[model samples]
Target chain A: MSKKLLLAASAAVLLNTSPALAASDADLAAIKADIQAMRAAYESKIEQLEQKVETLSAQQDQTAAKIATVEPAAGEQVATQRPATMQRNIKDSSFNPAIGVILNGKYNSFSENEGDVAGFAIGEEGERGTEGLSIDETELNFSASVDDKFRGSATIALAEHGGETEVEIEEVFIATTALPAGIEVKAGRFFSELGYLNSHHTHTDDFADRPLTNRAFLDGNYGDDGIQVSAVLPTPIYTEIGGGIFRGDDNPAGGAEGSDIGAWTAYGRVGGDIGDKTSWRVGLSTLQADDVSRDANEDEVNFSGDSDLYIADARAVYAPTGNNAEQEIIFQGEYFYRDEDGTYEDTGAATGAVDYDDGQSGWYAQSVYKFAPQWRAGARFSQLYAGDVPTGLVGSALDDEGHDPWAATAMVDWTNSEFSRLRAQYSREEVADGQEDNQFTLQYIMSLGAHGAHNY
Target chain B: MKKLSLMILTLGVLVASPSFAFAKTNIFACAPEWGALAQEIGGDKVDIYTASNANQDIHHMRAKPSLLAAMRKADLVICSGASLEIGWLPILLNKAGNNQVQEGGIGSVMASDYVPLLDVMQEKADRSMGHVHPEGNPHIHLDPNNILFLSKVIAERLSEIDASNSSAYQSNQVSFENSWTQAIAQWDNEGSHLKGQQVVVYHKSWTYLLNWLGMEAVASLEPKPGIPPNASHLKQVLQDIEGKNVKAILIAPFENEKGAKWLSEKANIPIIKLPFTVGGNAQSTDLKTMFDDTLQRLK
Candidate 1:
């Protein structure tokens, strides 16, 4: 009975255990299915996420491109705010070098009855024909700015001198404005500070022929190698002061050296607007040269012990309407003085010489009247006097002693523009020795392009 | 000498009067059109100067010393800045030595500033592209709408500089606008016929005008925007335009006409000469006349 009961119980237990195991298997299968479903859902979600990202990136690119297309340029807006006048006056600061060449050719024929001398290029005996065509001036100018503070200008002229091509330095100077009080410093070869005509170029002179004072005192367009400093003083009146130190030998004729053969000049000028329609200026200059050679002697002599020159100039211009281009009047005058200590050395009868202490003085006055927009008439008178000289000189010894020579000039000019001019002038020169000469000249000036400079 | 002294004294009195102490409102206009407009609006109250001369090629002017002197004393300065004056205007202003018209000064104004510019390059500007302003084309003065806006700006400036003359300045501006309106109406009437017209230009200078008139700029005489036309470019342009119904070939008086003329002759098209600026042609002395003459010439 116990065995039978135990077997029944075992069977019951087996049945219950098998049912439990079956239920556990079904639960495991359900759990596995749930895991597979979750895995598929996660994979699909990741794929969708990747597609969304790509679409967003493409939209961002499109937006960026549209932004670039719509934006206005920065430079254009900045330019629009500036004043028109200021904008019109703008300039490029970059260095753009320009090279230029100028060639001048002239031909003249005097009317019959005008006589010609050996050096003169016109006329036969008592009859003048065609004067040979001459290249009056040929020049090459180079000007540039190294930077904002430093600038340089140079001019070279090639002309026929003494039947040969001669090269001369017309202007070679470096100017700097990096100084105090509007001061400009110039160094190298440059023209001397003397007279109005002396400071102007041959092409810029009002008249074709130079004044007698310029010819006599300047001695063939005086220029020297030197250093110069000029400054415009900040004052109620327009004032300028300039000075320079030069090697005396650099003068056209070459200065003699024995004891410091150097030259120096200083000048001061004051100018101001007298009124709305008028302006005036007065200037004084002093020059000194040491150890100058005189009388063709091997030894040099310091005249005035060192020779002193004084020049005083005054100018007044009246423009009743304040438009000188239409109608105006101008008056100018200058006085010059030179003092020298006389010295002499005799070598023999073959080279005769005499010595005396003397001084020289000269003065000139000019008047100009403009009657029309482009027409002007002017007149000038100048005189020069030399103090007594020693006797026994080869050329006009007695006649030149303590005598005054004078010249009068009348001119008419027509200016087509600032760059072109036509002038006609007649002059009469009279010497103390009773020799009188008259000359008439007609001149035409044409500028090739836009190379004209401003007048100071 | 006595007569001269008396004359001098009389001249002195005139010059020393209190009325002569103040300088006139010195205005600098960049182009002849602006100059004429300034003169018309300012009347005798301001002295107007132009950077480009009537008889000169505006694009080729050299910035000279005399030009600087005029700018140095200016009370008000104006320019078409979109690079029109890029070649030399900056240098002239710096050297003019005037503090009143320098950058950031009240006296300075640029006409292009008030208007939107066109034809901007998306890439960097270089010489290979002929010569375009890196910023854009600055020739907005050709548009009448732009001029109207610019005139208002000028009136405001005039009033600021001379407060006492504000009423007069406003009145002048009103009259100028009225006249411009009348002129613009006439221009519209005439320009209506030119709509959709196909034209060839010598340079990009006419872009503003062409855009305003709704005319198509079929091509340019220049091979590229800034490059001069070569034989190959000209040939290509001619071939492209064959039987394309081009009405006119426009060229500015300042530009060399040899290439344009050659192209016109080869293409059998009418060559039209436009003034491009005030006082540029005999019929275009003032701003109103300039537009009238330009329209007439185009017709």
Candidate 2:
């Protein structure tokens, strides 16, 4: 404001001082005195303006300092907003873990009640449960890279058993990322890298339930605290070998009283693409547990010595569309051979424990055909190929007659989008004498968050 | 026996000779556009492989063993990061177990890191908002200006990865920049007519295009970021577009045409299925042609 007024005043002074304004000495002296007064007033005003400018600049610096100090408040703003409208500040920790939740619900109808297998000590999550609406495993998962050297993932599950809701820590693991020579070490409670289906979450499975081999051999997806170190060979073909030591907790491997490391697992896999449309992978895995104990369908079996399990899996996928994989065909199979050396006791009949050495095995094969953009049909056949137990048991559950327990299942699923899927499955089986094993299930899986991709 | 041993040794040497002589780096790109960009910068010093091709949704992908094999053999992995390859790349990296291309290594180049991104959500988005990237928009290669910055990053990395061919990569950077700058000028002049144009898009995929061409996306067919349009959103978009001077309805090739087709048939606006990236169409075989085709469609 002052500068503009000063400029106008100076202009007036200049206009009056032109050569055209010729006059006598008395007139010039009066003009000069007036000009001098005006000049003095302008000098005082300019000095005052400079002082005011400095004061304003200081005030602005104060305001900027306040803002700088309050910068941390911006972080609290992110969590304060609703999830749908929260702004993720890019500069706030350059890395964020992807969070995901998967919800699975199913309705089942069975011809007979098979929830309790008479002879075998059933594993946790052993049965498909009641014939009505039931919730399968619901998983909340988080994964991210912690640093240049490691990435981590944690999964917590809300599972239901006989109308009881239980919270379980399904997986918590940190994997080494910067290890040289194609080596990685993953440490935490995780699905053991033993078999094809043991490590995969139930949501990633094609079928609503686990296969017979996985259920029988690994006690329905074995999970425990372990450290696995895997290395991929530098050879051209894809070859990976990994070994782990786990605190035996779940079935097959009976952990020590205080979470002792009582189980060991190792696996090797070879995979490669055959052509533009076909790819295949083959893997071999083994698990050794100390002092495994469980009831095998009425035969109270306890293995005081080492129990060994061997598994082999092969999978092939053919996508007609190379990258546009709307339709595809997949063939997969798994085999398990378990040998246990222990004592057999029939607690139901109060039979004393006796020396026993037996081996059990199972196998399953499945084929899936994705016929259209949003639909797929698959069929699987699973059987307990071999079931040998200690003789003189109360129930003849593991006898040769009741052995060869097999089921054939067929399913069709329609995926409306990547986030949702509905599947219907039918299975016919007879695990024991005089039991009807016809079952039907309609299941829907809704994924609400970021889901990791399934492995081949 | 001696003769046979010598023959086998000779065969091994013959097979190993090429690797020692050239030692070209193998690059595995999650998307075809990145592969093409790598090819542009790396030239013969690198062998390029792509995980997703044209007309394939980069969001969901099957974990093919061959992709793992490619990743395993890759000396570098270039991808459109920001969780764009979240579905398949992690598993591939885990299975590949290759340290060179893991997240913090020099061999891992995320194009999103080099280019300034757009449409980064001002707020947190969840399933209710459909699928939203927390790290802003992951589609950075669509903007030609991003390519200039990314090319420099690529050249710098290629020089570091394959130091023997530093000059080749550096010269390529200069030549690529010259041609790219010229092409950008030509494209800008040609695209000047698109100024202040209003468009309808099926998704937020084309935001960079709209931002660059001075175009406004008044309405999107999708109700939310990733969700397909339902009845109300469609109806609202229809009413909102009324008297808006909308010029075109834009869509990418991979998007299903049902929604855009419905909107087009209802609104009488021409639908342009723009090839969004390299190999989007036969004419859009590379980066330059992609923009050329996109601008020509605008005209």
- Predicted model with the maximum DockQ: 2
Docking class of 2: incorrect
Q: Report the CA-based lDDT of candidate 1 relative to the real structure.
A: 0.63
| lDDT score of residue B178 within candidate 1 | 91
Which CAPRI level is candidate 1?
A: incorrect
- DockQ of each model vs. true complex: 0.06, 0.20
CA deviation > 4 Å runs, candidate 1: A1-73, A77-133, A250-253, A256-261, A274-276, A294-305, A319-321, A342-356, A391-402, A416-418, B1-299
Taken over the whole model, the C-alpha lDDT of each candidate is 0.63, 0.75
Compared with the true structure, what per-residue lDDT tens digits does model 2 show for residues A1-456?
A: 899999888887777776344546777888899999898889889888988998999998999888878864653243212123113212112435767789989999898876444344456665544578888778998887676567788999998866789999989999876675566789998888776788888887888777766776776778877787776665566777777777776677773556555777778888877765677889998887876655443244443555789999999887776543456788999988888777666565555675657777788999999886568999999887554555665453334445466778999998766678899999886665566688899999988656557567
| Residue A264 accuracy (lDDT) in model 1 | 69
**Winning model by lDDT:** 2
- List model 1 lDDT by residue over A38-58, tens digit each: 888887888788788888888
Tens digit of lDDT per residue, candidate 1, span B148-167?
76787777778777777778
Best candidate, TM-score-wise?
2
